[model samples]
Target: MIAAAWLFGVGGAILVGIGGFFRLARPALLPEDLRYLRRTPDEIDAAVPSLRGWLRLVFIVLGGYAVATGTLTIYLAATDIRNAESSAVAVLAVTGASSIGVMALVNFALHSTFRWPLSAAAALWIVATLMAVVS
Candidate 1:
């Protein structure tokens, strides 16, 4: 149970750390994501300056969502999940699928630099879930 909790907490922390970086970083867009779009920042500005603001907004919201997800996972692991029953797993499963799972999927599809790390994060989450079940 302790291992399960620790694993879950670490997985959640990954999300929180990455999300916070995205939210706080000056670049707004991940360098890889910008590279994927085939536009340097200056090139983007040259093409459509307004686009940068929109991208910033998008990343800000996405980053906030990631942080919220991590926080929720940590809270559940710390407070309820240890003693939880089937319903707890259900909640966590659904939450992960909708957030981290989806993020990983999109990153993979785009061949983004985030893909492998996000996939590893998702794996941590998956292993943590399995540990919870067995523990």
Candidate 2:
């Protein structure tokens, strides 16, 4: 159980960290499907020049938050697993699952190209959460 938790937690953290880094430091390096630069023609026409600046800031802030959240998940799971605290483990499991689930839902609703990857991650998290609960 501990091993599984660690695997899931660390994997999630790494994936999120990479995404955040790219979004913040080299957005152009991100894959076209994953990039936030895909604005519709109407959206582009309606957007002010300053909107790009605001969007960049928003992406940076949101990316940082995502990275922090992923890091917290890893830390919480590791600490709780190390302490052999089932209750703490359960809490982290539920929290991690819900967080990822929300992200998946948001991506789906937005019709984001990243939706499939987010959905897969969310599914894995949910399974890990369930296993933690039952184990």
Candidate 3:
């Protein structure tokens, strides 16, 4: 169970980092960005100068969240979760559902190219959830 927790955290952290880097690096982050917007970053900047900055800010916040999620998961695993505390199980479940489940849903809804990989990462969430329950 602890190993599963660590795996989920590491996988989620790596997966979440995708496109976040490109998002701030002055390029369209994902192909979905262009597919959904139908415009390049330059076009977006030309039409709405502040929009890109706002997006960057949002991604930065997401980046922070990515870090937090991984850290929190591992921290929980190293502590209360190992003892099979109900509260720890509940907390971990909530975190996984809110973060990985929601992210996977959004990617699927958007037909994001990253959807498959993100779904794989979310599978880890499910595995961890089950292990937590069985433990």
| CA lDDT of every candidate | 0.79, 0.66, 0.70
In model 1, the Cα lDDT at residue 91 comes to: 79
Ranking by lDDT: 1, 3, 2
Worst 10 residues of 1 by lDDT: 26-35
> What is the C-alpha lDDT profile of model 1 across 1-42, one tens digit per residue?
667777777877887887787687836556776768888888
Against the true structure, what is each candidate's TM-score? Answer: 0.84, 0.73, 0.79
Query: How many pairs of residues collide in each model?
Result: 0, 0, 0
What would you estimate as the lDDT of candidate 1?
0.79
Which clashing pairs does model 2 show? none
RMSD score of candidate 1 (Å) = 2.0
At residue 53, candidate 1 shows an lDDT of 85
- In Å, residue 120's CA in model 1 sits off its true spot by 0.9
Model 1 bad stretches (over 4 Å): 39-43
C-alpha positional error of residue 62 in candidate 2 after TM-score superposition, expressed in Å: 1.0
lDDT by residue (tens digit), candidate 3, 6-95 = 655565565446435533453325678777778886787789888766777777777667667767776777677766677877887788
Candidate topping TM-score: 1
